[model samples]
Target: MPKRSNYWLGAGLVFGAAFGFALKGIFIKSAYEYGIDTISLLSLRFLFSVPFYIFILSRKRIQEESHPQVPTITWLKLFAVGFVGYYVSAYFNLLGLNYITASLERILLFVYPTFVLILRAILLKKRITHLQWLALGITYLGIVLAFLKNFDAHQQKNIGLGAFWVILSGFTYAFYLISSDGLIAKLGTTRFTSWVIISALFPTLIHCYIENRLDIFNFPIPVYIISMSMAVFSTVLPTFMLSEGIKHVGSGNASIIASIGPIFTIFLATAFLGENIWLEQIIGTVFVLIGVFLISWKGKK
Candidate 1:
């Protein structure tokens, strides 16, 4: 009974995380309306988020001080994972969002689980289960249908380019999760997350510096409010919740719960951003959700 209760609690947490993450597109779009550029906005997000990470990291360091020393190599691995996973992947995703609808961007980003599956098969020499192949087929077909609609509904060249960047974001994120699996298992979710975020924050600052366009004082107040909300609600809150959810419900079930994110994003986009939803998007989202369900569901068996 306690385990069952925990499972429900974890599911709730995961759903909350998904909902929070789904709000990111809406927030970014709102920020853009204030004439805030991507780099500055991204910088603001990390700036607010970094203090939380520092607190988390400090607590973790104190806790682990009594334990056997961590190897230098481990820190290097964490740094590498942070760079490619959060910094690079997020930058590309933000770039894609500049050209694509929030709904489309969320849908594309949600396909990372599928990428993780495929990459594992190819790189790890894992056997491709029959059900997985079916999931892959469904997911790809859905993506194709959605892409066709996007191409038809918007600027063709921009849609095509945006889709490419979003897809690359998904790929990089998948690779990050797959590669960092062992580290996550060893370091505990919150601790590992703290280190990764801390590592990623530095690079983000460096990139923002290189862009050299962030006149931080001159931006309107709404941008600051929205960016801070983004840092707390979308970035820090969801990340820790998802990590805790994985601890209770396990990653597979957590992922299945998170599959709702794209749908939630579509609704938010329509209501807030006034983006239209068409039949193709509905059908594509359904297919993608089912595909993700199949993959995550089968992993438990």
Candidate 2:
């Protein structure tokens, strides 16, 4: 494939991943309405997601026999990756939803690109390009403008803690992105995504077991339905898309592209959750589009 094709393909995949992930805020809030705790809800999401991953892994193994067997050390890294990416990151993200509005949570979580910028520079020794700096600045400004009105200053207690949790979620996920960005290139996107998600399931299940939250059969049917939706649409699909996207466009660009997630979240919130869109948010959305255009445009010199 041509370089231009790869770039646009990667951009498109990351955009789709962002959209899929943006749906998660709505999914969690809906399930929470039925009184499911965060651990249990996460457990259900993992459980619902695993079988599909297994199917994918199995199919890939049979069809793509040419790739070398993965090293044991890499598997270890994958386990650690899974722990950070899925378990720690996901757990905190859902936890924050309990304390804050979905829009605010998305805003805080989207801050991960900043972390990604720093981590990539330190870990990979890659310089931050001027375009990325400009894109990040504009992207963040848009998020702030878009969210400023929606987040109530007078909201109930623990807003600070909630913001911290979601920020933690983003920070940990940046580590995941940096770690997986390289792995996905080496191990093949399908195999790496499936194994890491499967590995993450272990810690999630163990935590659920320790919490005595593994009783999946008792949730209301709506909770099960929502969890299944999250598993397929948000967790499984987006995870694969993101890894493949990183393979195509590299992690920093992917992260910036995904900053669109928060905007999508608010739009989805307005559509599904009856949230109102403000004029400032519309202006912010325009700025976000410009940032994205800067990232996606091919004429950067």
Candidate 3:
């Protein structure tokens, strides 16, 4: 393939993955309406996704001289990341969604890009350029505007708590992104993802136990279908497409493209869920796009 064509193909994959992720939020909201709690929802979601991941891993033609063993310490680290990053972050996100609009939840979650930049700077001792800082400011202003416009006088009571959890989830997700990059380099994306999913099983199982809803056989047909969709549409397909896109376009471009997800979600929420898209959301979306572009853009003077 030509370079230009590869770039466009990668761009398309990124957009598709973003749309898949945004649609997952809609499914979560719908599942809640069917009386599925976060734990049961997560358990079923990962349960269905695990086999798909394993099948992908199994198809790799590379044969090991010996079955590659992850060291105990590495297992612990992977498990910790999975538990804190995936399981915990997901739990809080679902909990916050119960109180806030999906659009609001998305904007709050988009704050993670800024968090990623800041966290990288802190942990790696790297300084962001002036343009990157400006981008961050613009993006944060947009996020604040979106929040203010979405605020309701009647629902002001829970906004603080909801915002706190949502932001916390974003932070956890950022950590996951940063930490997993190194592991992905070492283990390859598919194998690394499979391990993380397996590690996540422990926390998710505990969560299901705490919620006391382990009876999957009792779930309604619609709930089963939606849960399976969450696995196939949201988890497996999107992740594979994203991994391929990242391979072709590189992570920097992929991140820039992925930043558009919140804007897409805002519009989707408006069209499908009857959520209002305020002028503030439009302005915020612009800022976020600018910020993401600045952070990811490369140039030389």
The TM-score obtained by model 2 is 0.82
lDDT of 1: 0.86
Q: Whose lDDT is higher: candidate 1's or candidate 2's?
A: 1
Question: What is the C-alpha lDDT profile of model 1 across 1-301, one tens digit per residue?
Answer: 2399899999999999999999998999889889887778878888899899889878777977476567888889999999989898988888888888899899888889888888988998988899899998998888887777776775434787888888999999998988798888777778788888778888888887788745665799999999999999999999999988888888777888899999999999999999888899889989988888898888777
Q: Is candidate 2 or 3 superior in TM-score?
A: 3
Judged by whole-model lDDT over C-alpha atoms, candidate 2 comes out at 0.81
Ranking by TM-score: 1, 3, 2
Best by TM-score: 1
What's the TM-score of each model vs. the native?
A: 0.94, 0.82, 0.90
How well is each residue in 1-301 modelled by candidate 2, as lDDT tens digits? Answer: 4399999999999999999999999999889999999999999999999999999978887897576877888889988998999899999999999987776677667666567776877887968779877977886787677656656545436867887788889999989977886787778778877888888899998898888747768978999999999998999899889978978888668866886887889888778876566787677766666665565452233
The positional error of residue 93 in candidate 3, measured at the CA in angstroms, is 1.3
Best-to-worst ranking by lDDT:
1, 2, 3
Candidate 3, 159-261: lDDT as tens digits: 7677788889999998998888777776788777777877787789877876684765577789889989989988888888898898778877788788778
Question: Which residue pairs come into collision in candidate 3?
Answer: none
Clashes of each: 0, 0, 0
Q: Can you list the residue pairs that collide in candidate 1?
A: none
Superposition TM-score, candidate 3 onto the true structure: 0.90
